[model samples]
Target: MSRGFLPRQHGAWAMLLIPFLFGMFAAKPVWQHALLFLGWLLAYLFVYAFLQWVRTGQIRLYGRPLLLYGALLMPTGAALLWLEPGLWPLVPLFIPLFLVNCYYARRNRERSLLNDLAAVVQFSLIVFAAYELGGGSDWRLAAALFAFSVLYFTGSVFYVKTMIREKHNVKYYWVSVGYHLALLALAAICYPPGLLLPLAVLLVRAIWSPRAKLTVKQSGMLEIAYSLLITCSVLLVYAV
Candidate 1:
């Protein structure tokens, strides 16, 4: 017998977990937010299944069970709105992004740079929502969190492109390196000094990792370690 599992989008999961954790850390965690997070995760899983269904059109891959799961999870997610009715205003804002994602999925351009940035926006929204869920009312903090997430994930897009799709493309490789360096400089000039820690690590990785000719697993493991360091640095900065 085999057990059913939720759709596993490995890279996407990392994006989801990291930003959500950062948001929770940036604000006080409460049970309601925890519940909301659980619902949000389930909702994403449902969306993943739905998108896959649209992309593949294969019932076996995402059939009745997934539909059922998505249906059941709706109320679970509705709990979040009940927790804070203020979030109701935010729902309409997502419609355009959802349409963008759907359009990309329909065209099989989900991995395109535009779509990738859209994903970054979506993930950043999760952090912003988390901040709100934690009762944070500071617009500046929310904006900062959203911008940081976008900056980090956009770099991830270039890094992944260099490693895989554009592996042999010298132009993209140099672009990735340049972007990383620019990000480091920007962090140093605009943000707290502590940000330099992870930005420097990212810069070094961009400059050196691709040249090292590491295998896919090696690259992924290195990224995970780097992400951990970035998250830790953020926590430390806020802690002090």
Candidate 2:
């Protein structure tokens, strides 16, 4: 497969999969969940390729992947929607967010915090979509899971900036720490006691990981671990 066929953003894979898995586990899984995931995966690829084309104006490089992914995605997505027509309404919610991403990409500001948050919101919305796909009935739990995904991934955006893009910037480091602390506080007030453990761990990592002098790959690996921890924590707290 061409590199263009796959999304190069490693952290995005976690953002894409973890919340969907959390939602699937939160409700009763059906065979359609597999189909939903495939369509979701293809959609991400299609969007990534499209964004690359927009960013660089290198249509020749990205155009093929964009077309191929789109070709694959349309039928897969239509099939999923055909099976569960309820998903039709969720499509509109994503358009504005996608436009935000496109605007940033066109400006080559894809790393901007606002653009990152927009992507986070899109991924977080997938939690609800997956929840509904699995026949989840508890609106409260679905909404909670959506909020949790947004909160954790948004914190991740800050923490990762502190680790890499803003490593030498003291103000951004504190911003990341403060955001994580705020997340912990919010979780304590609004979430179950079981959920606090993962948030606390996230806070600890935000404080300590950058100072630990870890490499980018090490930081990424730790994030994968943290993502799993949060997923499992949510499952134990709400799904069980």
Candidate 3:
């Protein structure tokens, strides 16, 4: 397979997989969940290709991926919807968020914090879709999962900017630290004790990682570890 056939945004894979898996594990797994995940993955690939084509305006470069992923996604999506009509309600929620992404892509401002948040919200909402598909009935748990995913990924947007695009911008660094600290405070006040561990870890990294001057690969590795830790913690607190 060509490199273009795959998404180049490595961080996005975590965003894509963690919430879906979290929700799936939160409830009983059914065969339909498998189909749902396949459709979900294909949809993301299709969207990524579409956005790249929008941003670059280079049909010669992005046209193949656009056509291939879109073609693949259509059948998978149709099948999932046909099998589970319950998912229809989620379509409205996804469309606006997707349009936000497209808007930013067209303007080449895809890295803006607002655009990042829109993407985070879209990815985090997958938790609900997965939870529903898995027969999860606990609305409270599903909502909490969504909130946690959004909170973590949003902080990730700020932290990543500090480490890369805004490396020399102290204001952005402090904003990242401040955001994590606020989350820590909120966890202390309202969340379960179990959540504090992951929140504290997030805070520590938000404060220390940039100062340590880690390379992009190192930073990404740490994010993967953090994502796993958060996923495990959520499963222990809500699923088990």
In candidate 1, position 33 carries an lDDT of: 77
Clashing pairs in 3: none
Residue pairs that clash (backbone atoms under 3 angstroms), model 2: none
Scored by lDDT, the top model is 2
**Model 3 alpha-carbon drift over 4 Å, by segment:** none
Q: Per-residue lDDT tens digits of candidate 2, residues 127-238?
A: 8888999898998988988998999999999999999999988999999999999999998899999988889999999899989999888887888889889888888877
| Residue 55's lDDT in candidate 2 | 95
**lDDT (Cα, tens digit) per residue for candidate 3, span 192-222:** 8998989899999999999997988888888
Best by TM-score: 2
Over 4 Å off in model 1, which ranges? 1-5
Considering lDDT, which of the candidate structures 1 and 3 is the better prediction for this target?
3
By TM-score rank, best first, the candidates go 2, 3, 1
Residue 10 in candidate 3, Cα distance off native in Å: 0.8
lDDT scores of the candidates, listed in order: 0.79, 0.91, 0.89
